[model samples]
Target: MRRLGSALLAVSMFAGCGGLETEPSPESLTSPSFESQQAPITTTDVDVAPECKGIITFVNTATFQTLDAYLPSNVVTNLVNRRATAPFTSLADVSSVSLVGETRLKQLEQGARARGAINSTCVGIFDGLALSTSDAAAIVSLVNTIDDSELHDVLPDAWNGAANLLNLRPFTSAQAISNVAGIGEVSFRNIRNAATLSRPFEALAAAVNAIPSNGSAGVQLKRHFDWWNEVTAQHGYSQGGPTCFGLEPSSVPYGATIRPYLANSAEVMAEVQSTLDYVDADTKISPNVIAAGMANLSARTQGRSFKGCIFSYADDPWSRHNVAIFVDTVNGFSVFSETWWAE
Candidate 1:
């Protein structure tokens, strides 16, 4: 694909499948059910001023060309010919391209529609880039402009309520938006099928990009945890000593960033269930004991984030899965066990 110079539309093609090399986790088996995903996106021709953050529909990838400084002219030529990348169906496909990266990728993918129209005149979606989460209202307002749109039904009231209350962060993929608010299964399916969602992000995409990743979350956790080095040093759990020391909680900064990409909260809720699983096998506890265990440890947070709390409590863990066990935060009297959600 690279030999043909296909870097024009959001960078070189990464694969025949949607962009990211990683496949949807085992949970994504459900994607096919709502998979009536159209090949070409659908859009209305309301001529929007670039200042309005209008959606630019690129009906055909095979003939699209742009000379703006995004990609080499030669690469754009290759994409126009389909000699390099396959027809881009969604941002998921373009996002996988190696060179596009998140910033430019968001701009191009959000600005241009796929397999739909031949729009050459619309907002220069990628003109300037900035990140922030306060744009959801404006973005939603822009989406509302899509006359006779179905988005209102798809996202629903409660989900929007969750968005407003939590000040839900901006998100890139339908997969990621599924993360924050209490957007449940039915809504998620409708969204995954909302193919045009790739383009009409308006200001939403910018804010989503601004939100931090798990990697950054991990970094902050470790930084705040510098205060706990004293506690870890005395218990033989010193940084890099035996267990969680110097384990780089920062490496998992995206822990909180897990919502959209997580696709669902069962993974988040699993944090609690995992503790139960471990307790079930590791200890011969009953329903009564399990209830008491949670009742006792639930208040131990001391206002710390779930994962890095100096103290860890396992209501009951079947075994460790994604969560990590360590004295990196704090170990309580070497009690039952210390467990926290690992992003």
Candidate 2:
């Protein structure tokens, strides 16, 4: 197999390009041309623990609620105040659409898709490309897991090797949450440098949204191949190899033994409490449920940050397929809330 440096150089030379115009860092590639509206999805009902009955009330969180708490809603109206913002790239294909006055936009999406290829980490990248209603339904059918059509999988590959995405790439859930402060900058930089490609923000957004919330670290690594070309084009160098080829590979987070919990309400409470206790006692990091929710929203808003926390649900409220809550991809961390909720 080709090494990373060799592969990248080979890919770049074959494409007849040494490098496209250097663009701003991923931090500067913030902001999409369109504005996204936030709507709340119905939450699944879970029994509340008596110990925390009133403390954990229902908070209606819409798609919009997950922003960095810095961007204004009416971005279009306040063009001057509107900062660059990466729009959420849902898992749908729109390459064949023919909306009035949107021909160029459709071409843009298609070009972005072709330019920003897929990888092992984002094997589902094509699934996230925004498309017409027919295409959306088709992609939804392929997901085959969740019932909700809107909840497309956020595969981890979205935030990997591309040099421009370095700022957006996250190593941990906490880092993902903290990166929101600079999303606008990333969005701007991506758009400014689109001449090298077409629409970096759109392409990157599609990659980010295609990440699945559940999968092994290997699945995550596989998706990394999809974007190899984009990485070479962006960095002005050729490189290739398995996504996580050289980096010392590690197990997904929370992929180990699970703690047992009773099915009763009080048991559920104890279970959740225990999970938090485990996070605190063992890793020195307690579960920050609210903060996690916000981080997910922020990641969606910026269309970047691919780190997520996956909790295992079999026994421990935080049980993952294993332990350490391995990130399926690079998007925002998943809280794996089912493990903590009342059964």
C-alpha lDDT (0 to 100) for residue 102 of candidate 2? 29
* lDDT for position 226 in model 2: 17
So what's the TM-score on candidate 1?
0.24
lDDT of each: 0.29, 0.22
* Candidate 1 per-residue lDDT over residues 1-343, each given as its tens digit: 0000011222212233212224222233213431222123222111122222211123122233331244555444443444234545433344344444445544453434232121222222221211112122223333333211133323443446334323544444333444445565444333332322223221222222233444412111110112233223333222223222222334232111221111112322244445445334224334454454343233222232222222222223422112332221221111112233333
> Which ten contiguous residues of candidate 2 have the minimum total lDDT?
5-14
lDDT of 2 by residue, 67-139 (tens): 1122233321231112112111111111122221223323333333233321111111121122222222322
Q: How accurate is candidate 1 locally (lDDT)?
A: 0.29
The TM-scores of all predictions, comma-separated, are 0.24, 0.19
Segments of candidate 1 deviating more than 4 angstroms: 1-62, 65-75, 82-85, 88-107, 110-274, 277-343
